[model samples]
Target: MNSVTKARYDGLADWYDDRFVTGAEPHQPGLLELLGEGSGPCLDIGCGTGRNFETIRASGREVVGLDYSSDQLRLARTRTDGPLMVGDAAALPFPDESFDTVMVMWVSTDVDDFGAVVREAARVLRPGGVFVEYGVHPCFNGPHVVYNEDGGRTAHPTYRQSGWHEPAPWWGEDGIRRQIGMSHVPLADYLNAFLTAGLTVQRFIEPEGPPVPHSLAVRATKPA
Candidate 1:
């Protein structure tokens, strides 16, 4: 993880917790659906403020939450007694095949190398283990897209652009993107990261919401 990214999240930890404390985040239902009834030990990468701790634990899976920001993990303590650590998603401090399930939620845009993070997630996952990725839909969301007043989105020709982008004027003044900007990963690059990590894609979903789908979820597994 980038130090700047860590600092950004650290500063926003409190605001972020308060903003989503209601647990009504739109992408959550689909995230849980793709997560399925968890099994064995699970790793919740980028588990900001432990938002998904209850859902993951509800399935009887023991979860270890990890994030790049210590401040984020500090707040996560209040949500769950589960083990929380300050760590990089791209270089997980764990042994090979250490987890039966690995899930990363809303972290792609924050990481410097999304592919490297996926590779690390795959490395820690045991054979036949499941890997879940749920986050903003790359094709329809990101700096390349402009949201209009009528609930319509105009995707600019910059869909192929990948990397950190300046905050767009359309972004909410109080939004996370406006605060720290965003990194854009084109649709193909986003999906290719899993394939390159030797994960077999099982399911891909564009969850229902808004005039255009804002989020996506993917379920994959390491070959047994």
Candidate 2:
């Protein structure tokens, strides 16, 4: 994780937590469905403020949350007694094959290298272990796409421009991207991370919502 990203999250932890206190973000159901009832021990990368804790635990998985921001982890501590840590997603602090399931949620935009993070998630996963990714739909959601008042979207020429982007005027003043900035990964690059990590893609989902789907979910597994 980039130090700047870590600091940005740390500073916004309280605000972020309060913003999602109900944990009813529209995409949560899709994320949990894609996550399924996988066996534990599960590792939640970029587990911000424990938003997914209740649902994940309800599925009977023994979950461990990890994030790069200490302040975020501090708030997470309130949501679950399960272990939580401040660590880099690209370099997880665990032994190889240490987990039965590994998940990354809404984290791709925050990491410097999404592929490296996926590789690390694969590294810590046991054979046949599940890997889940649930986040913004790269093709339609990003700095390059502008959401209009008519519930339509406009794609800008910068859609192919991948990497860290400064906040643009189009971004909502109080939105996450405006607050911490974001990294863009083209649609192919987003899906290729799993294939590159040698995982079998089992399911791909574009959850139904809004005029254009704003979220995506994927489920994969390591070869047994």
Candidate 3:
């Protein structure tokens, strides 16, 4: 993750879910349903607040949640008493092929080298295991978007510029996303990360929206 993003999440970990994403898991249900019936361990990357624990647990796998933010894990423990690790997403502290599944939730926008994280995720999952990602639509949301104007509008900006974007008055909303900062990854660059990691993407979809997609879910599998 980016240094600025790491600090931002570290600071907002405590009340992040409550303030911004108060409802159930913000992403589509298909993400969890894709977790499969694997009896082996499953790893959840950037598992902020552990909100997805219930869905992962119901899949009947030994679930572990990993996050870079101590503040987030502190709050996560209250929600699910599961094994949680405090570490970077780019370089996960786990053995190669240690988990049967790896899932990253809404963390792609924050990581500096998302491809590194994807490779790490593929490294940890056993061959033939699955890796799931539930995130806001990369092409539609984040820095290039102006939510206050026209009830959420997208502006003209080069999509390939992926990195930390500071808050500006024109962006709208003094929300924590601005405080914590964001990294905008274009749609193609986002998919390329998975391909470079040797994870074959099987399913990808974005929920309905006019100007842009609100969120997206992707399912990939490590080669057997």
Error of 3 at 14 (Å): 3.1
lDDT of 2: 0.86
Instruction: Put down candidate 1 lDDT per residue, 108-222, tens digits, no spaces.
Output: 8898899999999999999999899988899888878887889889898777879888777777788778876789899989999999999999999998778688888899999
Better of 2 and 3 by TM-score: 2
Compared with the true structure, the alpha-carbon lDDT of candidate 3 equals: 0.78
Superposition TM-score, candidate 2 onto the true structure? 0.95
Error of 1 at 44 (Å): 0.4
Pairs that clash in candidate 3: none
Candidate 2 backbone collisions, by pair: none
TM-scores, one per candidate: 0.95, 0.95, 0.90
Which portions of model 2 miss their true places by more than 4 Å? 21-27
Q: What is the lDDT, from 0 to 100, of the residue 211 in candidate 3?
A: 53
Model 3: per-residue Cα lDDT at residue 31 = 64
lDDT of 3 by residue, 1-224 (tens): 54666677886765687775567554345665677677767799988888787778778877688988888888888867669888888888999999888999888778888788889999998988989988868767777666654666655474567776766665556565656777777888788989999998898877555555668888899999
Residue 54's lDDT within candidate 1 is: 77
Q: What is the C-alpha lDDT of each candidate?
A: 0.86, 0.86, 0.78
